[model samples]
Target: MSDSTVEDFLKSYNPEVRQLVLKTRAVVLAVIPDAIEQVDSPSKIIAYGFGLKYADLICAIAPYKSYVNLIFSQAAQLPDPRGLLTGTGKRARHVKIKTATDIESPGVRSLLEAAVASMTH
Candidate 1:
């Protein structure tokens, strides 16, 4: 996303949701500091990836009025021994983050790590 677009998107959400989204962004950046961040306005999401393609996407942050969802694209291939992931989609899975604590929960970091590691640079 362009700097203005991302700023506008972040400005649209409630403080709680904004906080969760930023927290997720921090985690994603920590995991892949060079990851590209983009906005999908139609889908209402901020996606993180290595390159400029959907196939290169690692995950996304979808914010709602009350919470934010951390979405993993290749969820089925990721190892989640702590079972932090939840969703019924064929390929994607999400972790609903309602609080800052959710971002620091068990398996969250590892899931992000594993997601990055699963990819071939």
Candidate 2:
């Protein structure tokens, strides 16, 4: 979808949550410029493909009441250092972001970069 579509989605939330979603979306798009990304309707969750060809490296941003959840669809397969991710069942794991600083962590950044790299391959 268009950039405005993404922006509108982010703006629908409260200012605090809106800013967090906007920043996270920027970082993800910066890493995966050619991502097959979309702003899903109904829930308005933001999702991006690591590459046009990859299936396992999609990242979706889901906001909770007090925090944002970075849902890594392929987290179960990625190298889990720092033990920052959690999930039940199988093949789904996520790292919760309570504040902007959470995104500043090296482990978190690495996870996003690794996802993009792995998908590009």
lDDT of every model, 2 decimals: 0.88, 0.74
Flag regions of model 2 displaced more than 4 Å.
50-57
> Model 1, poorest ten-residue lDDT window?
1-10
Q: Which ten residues in a row have the lowest lDDT in candidate 2?
A: 49-58
**Best prediction by lDDT:** 1
Task: Give the alpha carbon lDDT tens digit for every residue of 1-121 in model 2.
Answer: 6878877776656777776776777677776777778676676577787444336447888866667888887787788779988887377688888788887678887888877766667
Model 2 TM-score relative to the real fold: 0.83
Pick the TM-score winner: 1
TM-score for all predictions? 0.92, 0.83
Q: Clashing residue pairs, candidate 1?
A: 1-38
lDDT at 118 for candidate 1? 84
Question: In model 1, where do residues sit more than 4 Å from their true spots?
Answer: 1-4
